[model samples]
Target chain A: MSADNLTRTQRDDLRTIAAMIVPASDAYKVPGADDPAIQADMLATLGRDTKLVAAALDHLARLAGGPFAELDANRREAVAQEFRKVGGAAAATLVRVVLQCYYRDDRVLRSLGLELRAPFPKGHVLPDGDWSLLDPVKARGGTLRRAP
Target chain B: MKDPVDVLIIGAGASGAAVAWSLAETKMHILCLEQGGWMNPAEYPSTGRDWEAKFYGEWSSSPNVRGRPEDYPINDDNSPIKVVNYNAVGGSTVMYTAHWPRLHPSDFKVKTLDGVADDWPIDYDALTPFFEENDRIMGTSGLSGDPLSPLTHPPMPQQPMGLSGAIVGKAMNKLGWHWWPSDTTVATMDYEGRARCINLGHCTPACAQGAKSSTDITYWPHAIRAGVELRTHCRVREITTDENGMASGVVYYDKDGVEQFQPAHVVIIACNGVGTPRLLLNSKSNRFPNGLANSSGLVGKNLMFHPYAQIYGYVEEPTDSNRAPPTCLWSKEWYDTDLSRGFVRGYGVQFVRGAGPVFEAVVSEQKGILPWGEDHHRVFRKLNGHRLGFSAICEDLPEEHNQVTLDPVLKDSHGIPAPKIDYTISENSRKMMEHALARGREVLETAGATDICINSPIPWGGWHLLGTARMGTDPNRSVVNEWGRAHDVKNLFIVDGSIFVTSGGVNPTSTIQALALYIADQMKQRLANLFD
Candidate 1:
């Protein structure tokens, strides 16, 4: 169940679990975690944490008593819920690895309408928020620390 | 390699680089040794997809976790707070949040005002000129005439106070507290060969745009042009002494692991709180068996690490969390003592934009709030831009028992002894944290926040390392004198946060650099009598 050389069934289970964490939706037009790019990136970055990912996927398979990929969407979601409920090192690692990889994907950023480029060279500009709300604090003059 | 230089400084970070820049003006033969090499801004995380990995991977700000060839592992078994620092030419400034708040006038007179920590030998008024000079050199960006500080104008304009800051500011106003734009080392416009900040939001791990004022780009260039020689990957093992017990030079391991003794007429130690003490303590000699310049036995004593308390909440309004630097607004309402709060000293609070999505997910999971399955997206969507956070930077008193000692077993790649930390949160700090958390929650509630999360004593919050080799007027109670000269050795000087008498409730880099410049001035004034 190595991340680099995952068995087909293990890979399928991982994809299914990933999709459950970040499901494909028409509303956002975002690819699910099952997208090949997202899955590959997750597996690549899991490096030392591959075993933890495998254990988490294995936990899902054991709960479902079969390949999690073959289960219905609701059943797969249920199994993920159970895996998360078990709450161990493997479960937490899986959640972190998946979320980290998923959010970093260009497709996810595009789906959220965020600029899909590196943050340097040209950074994002935030519109000024209503700062008049701070009038009261400014009007109170200043609060100084006790004199020495 | 060369003839004995006039001045040899160790560590090319914030303080060391400032010393080099200032002393280079005198046209002295200045040579600085850095344990790590210069970092290329092009290789920063902002240029790649794996930026978040920098926080936990090799580029991590924590030396214990970064584990570079030059970094020595710290033994923090006895302390809950873990040290977070980098060993590079620019040092921790490379990964700092760039929150540049000056110490209040009361901070220098803590002993007289609160009867707590010892007063600094030099007061705020004495350091004001140096602070202004550092501001000009570093290109600090903020509004002028901060009521708490003496400085009138900064070199650059203030960075925008984002939505998170507005919400927090509103909360402070409702609470009738003092809030202001945080003075930071980020440039708003092009200044001093550095580009303006593009608001990449992530100031830590690295700033590819060269907007952040890391000394590698800020002071190193000027120092080098002024004839200061900087040798990277040169880890100083110990400060060697002459037959007369005067400071001589240092025995350091070169990049190729070759041991070499570089002699100098004067030795300046700016290797930070942990590194400075570790080098001195390991430099055991016949004259000073305890440590070099440790006649007062305060070289590694009275270590102060400011304990932190963080409060996070979710707002209903969306925000551009990734559009600005993490910290923007801060309040000093509770920065001074109020005996009614059951604490002698107090803490300052800063408003922070929510972290990136990955960070939010990890924090949510840690807090047991991240829902599983179908509920995940619902909760995540609710958190995304609506999240806001604030941190209470509490002052830490110098406790002799809480100190940095040489680790018996662990050593760096250069075979230099590692530093072992023994620290516990004081009752005063605890009480301050408790009060701060309550105030933070109240502010968030006033700002229309729901589902607030509170985490006290953030484990990885030992950012400002200070008070180890503290400065004082009495040689029996401190390591360095008013001008940062070692009390026990005439030619030895310390110019880092380690010489701080009290840990102020704010970032210490500005003060550290100012003190370094002040010490360099002292050295220049008595160049002929330096070793007398």
Candidate 2:
């Protein structure tokens, strides 16, 4: 919603790029990066490095031969592949920000069957694993350094 | 503020806290000054939605990146290794992984055995009792009778190794290597009022459950309860000496940036390797022109950083990698020297879990292993829980050229000269790393891992800063004597990793604490003629 550093078209193009990276499917009803919450997070992260975002978006627009958001799905995919091929700091930053925002969303956690709670206050409990697998290691005696 | 205390400690870190706890038994007034304040568990990153961001932001373990008001940055331009430290009351323990391992018996006599690096003034047997005492106080959890180490019992039960540990253990068995569940300072059950670990998995930035044994919760509370005074946010600028060249007290900047001097009967420097040398070098006077205790001119020389490497791979099965601590299992089979490998000392290998989901996604994308469009999810899922990693902690010998010096231009917030680190990996360490990487690949392959990616020596791996002011018997070659007492100034002592003569192949926290306790005992016995 607060695309302070980005124009309207740039925001839409970024949303499209994020959606292509992690598109919504029926198998896991997770929201794509086009979701409002996810977009806001992505925009905030992108706002930190506005120059990098601007450069990456300009590259995508040139690859698609127009506004990247106006391109079809196939064209968008091709343009994204072109951007990936010409990998630079801007492209890497864009991918990193988009992935960080998408994967940390609550819907993604639910889709992955994980509780959306803080890691502390009520930490996760792991079942006791098989200790017998270490029997062989324990059977081998001490391997101390030999004294001079 | 009130009066000159019986003893003055410069840092409230691991060694300082331990020394305070031990010396409090003598009923002497003990005071400690810490540059950073107490860390509250409630303010930990895990309690927020943006927990992962903390690792890259304010909660970063490196002082160069964290940049708090009290932090002093290190000029690491000349070194391949970067220095990482946390300056709070618990020192680097606040952000450490809590992997506690003692030095081997031969680690004491490195010169006699390997004909390189000076032997420690004190041996492992002499410090065994203190190590055992520290384990009881710090609440370590492990099984007894590790063949690679001397026999010792932990007070708490061991943590679960989970699936990754099982796979790695089986691989070590196949390779006929010595692997064991690493002894950690995390509490399993409620021991000594700290809560049990719930496997939150973020042990580096901060442990919110109060499970990891940072010195603030482990030793500081006990010391404070026994009537020790700890002044937070007070940074010591220089150690002042009397007319006779004996350490009388220190001139420090208080919490409000006010300059003040506190006199004490005995002064102890527990401010780690770099900080200790910086303070000593900054305290230049007419009596000691080069530095305070630099008659030997070795105060900031012979710095050793344990060169580290991490090897990651993808396992075949879908196993849970986010359910346990960061590291719970390690191998010492390659710890000692093997002449055929063309290296002097060896390295320890640890099997650890990968970071959180977000971190993994970033790493995978950056490494070009995961594509951007359409193929992201597939590669992410394939590498999610089905990943394993091994980190090698290689021993770096003492080299006179790799040292800590005062930067002429760089100044901290207090206008003090910043510590300049000049270090490079030795040929011996490079050969050791090569051998360790090959061995790591063999282990991962034997354990049925594919798509293996082995990284070079990690750049941000200078967690264990040691050997700047090495301990020895002769005054001409060393800064401190066998008892951690300065050879030049009788009333001055250093009880941190700075007194280490050699950098061992494991984490240095356990040995640092034990040496602090041992030095405190020596002070108690020689109380009558301490300044003589």
Candidate 3:
């Protein structure tokens, strides 16, 4: 949980990979996970998850044969591919954390056309779908076996 | 306690709550001790915007993952399926999906019908009345004439099946198979004691609408109003025995970690399958050396879990998806036995609505269907709000090998040894799952779905814990007798999932509550001779 353990280079690598994971969606009008404000939230939340993030960064660097932060765009892409191929618990933790934080962002939620609030106190609703869809099954009834 | 209470019940979960409510009719002095406290819906994860991301912490369904003070650790390293439960006043019902379905008549006499498991001492016909009564009390919602279910037309009108249910229903119709609107213990409209559901998608992590009919909301309140005293945060260490080998009471730790012994005229254990057996095996006295009322040596044997197979795919049409209660339709086409299918018994197909946003992202990434890089949005858009699937709840047979023993190394906060599960998916269940997967995929394909995926015998589907302490007429083969009373110890009773002889292919919560009520009725009817 100690942020001091994660090298500055690792933090930069994490943000870089996060942006690649959820790049800016111009069509949907939603910013990427690496948007300044969103990335700040992500970094703050990553305090407790620093250990996993650091381990994942080290794994990416070792797999790429150098520091991920110093890698060029093409090399970063190749390294990410290799990292995805060699997926482990640490990588999964980072991915899970990243997606979770990204989805919870108010901007991304608004793009999804969902209310930027809790599900309860004003829970969602659905139309009462047609129940006659079961008429066919009702016509072909008596599927249960009797007890001997 | 100085004065012995008339009846002492352990574990104020699903079964315990119902029995307490039913036995309260006698106006007898009954007390139930629950390890977990009552849950506050206001504090439930759904109340926050980040619920989807936040619920993975304290609201987790797995006790081992949640690790709350009241939850005991289960050593499930030996089993393929991990146990998932919520330690609360409503028990696992707090986190249950509320797909309430009763066991078929043939389920009670499996030996006589398909010749696999032992026959239940009591039959489904005998439990029909109790089932109906429990449905009314639980405010069950469903349509009638479900030929597959033992009892159809749960007290409340059928909950509206959203578009997802319609798609699955039409698909099953195309296949000429059985499909019906699922009976659920969720309120469709405002009932006497509960409120209407507002479709808060997240049913697993606890529903905040008070629409889901958890015992805490259904039975515990009624039981409390009927003079049943329920004490929370009291973890029972062991069941104490008397010199004559008759029933006694329990030794438990209070909230402040103070040890106390409470005596009773009669003892009733309503802890679920795992907790029930763990308590019995831990209560080793000279009167019953092996374990209390475990002369048959089958106390913790024959553990049964409904192996789950999730089959889903992507569709073009957008659905209500995560905005509604997930399960509303089920097909029992393969529910009955078919020898040619390479399986003796069968499985039930429960339809699940698509995943929500966080779920879609996480699961799709895990499945490698949605990548993290460039194509992420394309794949995510294709699957989000368009995924429709169903899970096959496979019936498990009784095998002595898959048992729940006392974990010597692992113990709870109260210093009680935890339950160590040793289970393996049986070949019969595996065949059932495979058959279910193939048939389910065909149905989904017929429903105009693509990108099909099947996760067979999923490990996290260990929701139904059953058959650890089974009931039978033979003392050498069972822990309890025909009426849930222990054959070895008079005035000792067990009214929980532990007494299930065989695992039915559907959810067991409804059956568990009905059995509890039935046993309570039996106790009342034979009050004079109950201890005999």
Top TM-score prediction, candidate number: 3
Alpha carbon lDDT of residue B510, candidate 1? 93
TM-score of chain A of each: 0.78, 0.85, 0.88
The C-alpha lDDT values of all candidates are 0.84, 0.85, 0.86
- Which residue ranges in model 1 land beyond 4 Å of their true spot? A1-34, A48-91, A128-135, A143-148, B149-152
Task: Write candidate 3's Cα lDDT for B410-522 as tens digits.
Answer: 98887788899999998888888888899988988999998898787777789999998899999999999999999999989999999999998989998999899999999
TM-scores for candidates 1 onward, in order: 0.93, 0.93, 0.97
Every model: Cα RMSD to truth: 2.9, 2.9, 1.8
lDDT of 2 by residue, B322-349 (tens): 6568888878888887799898888887
Q: Residue B293 of model 1: what lDDT?
A: 88
Error of 2 at A59 (Å): 9.4
TM-score of model number 1? 0.93
Best by lDDT: 3
Alpha carbon lDDT at A75, candidate 3: 90
Worst 10 residues of 1 chain B by lDDT: B144-153
